[model samples]
Target: MSNELSVDNLVTGYGKQEIVHDISVSARPGQITCIFGPNGSGKSTVVKAIAGLLPAWSGRITLGNTELTGLPVHAMVRNGIVMMPQGGGVFPRFTVMENLRMGGYALDNKQVVEDRIEALIADYPNLQRRRNTAAGSLSGGEQMMVAIARALVTDPEFVMLDEPSAGLSPALVHETMERVVSLKERGVGVIMVEQNIREALPVADSVYIFAGGKRKFAGTQKDIRDDNHLMSIYMGGD
Candidate 1:
């Protein structure tokens, strides 16, 4: 598959301490390509650079045909790349509906934004049930649903989520993973950072493991499953 987003010779870090070494990666259209590794493995840092949350020390990041390196977060969003950082970024004091409205600000077409919000609520019924509730009142998993929905309000083509399943219960985690799988059916490209390798592997079209600031492995999910021993060596035994 070709790439919707591509990064070449990428290097980034904070205050002179490089966290990501020269790395090349790609996310193909209509697929879930995941980044997995233990903490501080440069997964989030590389993602932040791609999402325009951090400055790229060196490298090229291209989304579609446009260059994204050194662009601000808003610029990235304008390019149809929206990121939902870890913690969901929900507004504690705001109602679910209000939050959705804020997310749709970029859409000047009121009917379109409303239609998108309704579609999201329909997809996640739990969110529909709590449409008028304050975001802080919802449980962690529910909050995650809201966050993803808010990101979708922009009608983004590429959505990058950081540690999406972090605080959810087992059932909620499964549901969230299912949602990731479903994104491609909606024609959205997803790049996610996940700690739960076992769950993510089943849905990923292709997977990439980042270790020591470099890509340790990149292949189809079936390829990894075919060689169980290979996964343990490359993925650190889950």
Candidate 2:
């Protein structure tokens, strides 16, 4: 497992404002690389830029051998880049199986898709039990499961999560993070933007702190634990 995804000197912004400026990042294969920052620090914006929701104003984002700095979202997906947005990127009206099927829409192999679905169900009982339930009716935790399962449907090489643990009970948050960890066990690169810094730190193999649209600090969890530097840079200062 080497660098599965890499971003270099990225410069991007919305209509009139640039949020990510001259930024770079990389997610090593089978590793959980987390981007942590206070709100408005352009973390999610980075995800958008990578997932092709926003065009890269400048710089290169290379995934494996693909230079995907400005590829459209659809093209990115076909290229093995998929995003699991926060708040559960589930369609409220669709059943679990329906949502999962949509994820593999790009796949022409019907048997492969069906096999994968059955395998995911065996691994995640939560999804298996609620296969027929409308996604909207599930609890926040259950919905999160559906979202992750759906994203896996595409057989993504790298899965970017935007606050996977955001709005759930503590128990549910733990469940969501655990699910994310499971993805890594299966050897998928995960880049996440999480607000729960404390909980994320434990699972994060590498932690990146962003401030003013640039990387303020970067290191492993042990390198930053209980250190005042994180709060000094990521607190109200920025």
Candidate 3:
């Protein structure tokens, strides 16, 4: 099976108000696909639709050959697609270990879930040290770590992060982006919705720029770099 997630001409929004209009993008395993734009450009809406949180008004979302347009969130997890919403989306009252285990709730085997949690905690020493501590008690950066680790417990082929840098300090933003890039190194395709153009540009293998609910550009990193006009308009260039 192909390890690619494709969204073709997706149009979705809350209630009857359309926020995204005919936008399409794709991501491959081991690549970082950054969906970038300023606030209110509908970046998060697209991510939500792809993650099955919002139903597409008109489009097809597929994982390789498998149709995923209308599947529930849990169904998407089983399809190897996991989404980490903005603000880390951790269960504050749950312990760090418990949060990670929740990521694997769709799996039928408890042993598999426990084993994955153990491996993730071992890999992230901070999580290992605070395994029993409530996730809400950890620092912002640490909570982001928990969220990423929890998303990984499912061993997803595609991980979609909604503004992983939001509300983080400059240092923590850098740290979070580093962790996002690491997912590509692990052969997991990463679709990150970000407003920080500078931070997302460096790590993005493929780029999609949205404005007013429309995709203005979709190309490789080098293509985006070479477009001086686009840079001036979006990146505050000369």
Q: Pick the candidate with the highest lDDT.
A: 3
Worst 10 residues of 1 by lDDT: 229-238
With candidate 2 superimposed using the best TM-score fit, by how many Å does residue 15's alpha carbon deviate from the native? 0.4
lDDT of 2 by residue, 1-238 (tens): 4547988989988997989878888888688999988888889999999999999989998987778877888888888888988877899999999888888887788788888888887878988998998899998878888888888887788899999887788998888889889989988889999999877888898888888888877788877746576797686353
Model 3 C-alpha lDDT per residue in residues 1-238, reported as the tens digit of each score: 2478999999998999999999999999999999887777789999888888999999999989899999999999999999998978999999998899899998989899999899888989999999999999999989999999999998999999998888999999999989998888889999999877778788999988888788888887777545475565454232
| 135 Cα displacement, candidate 1 (Å) | 0.9
What TM-score quantifies how close candidate 1 is to the native fold? 0.89
lDDT of 2 at 50: 94
For all candidates, the clash counts are 0, 0, 0
* Candidate 2 structure, TM-score to reference: 0.94
Per-candidate TM-scores read: 0.89, 0.94, 0.94
Query: Model 3, residue 66: what's the lDDT?
Result: 92
Identify the superior model by TM-score, candidate 1 or candidate 2. 2
lDDT per model vs. reference? 0.84, 0.85, 0.89
Score residue 203 of candidate 2 by CA lDDT.
88
Residue 202 in candidate 2, Cα distance off native in Å: 0.5
Two-way lDDT contest, 1 vs 3, winner: 3
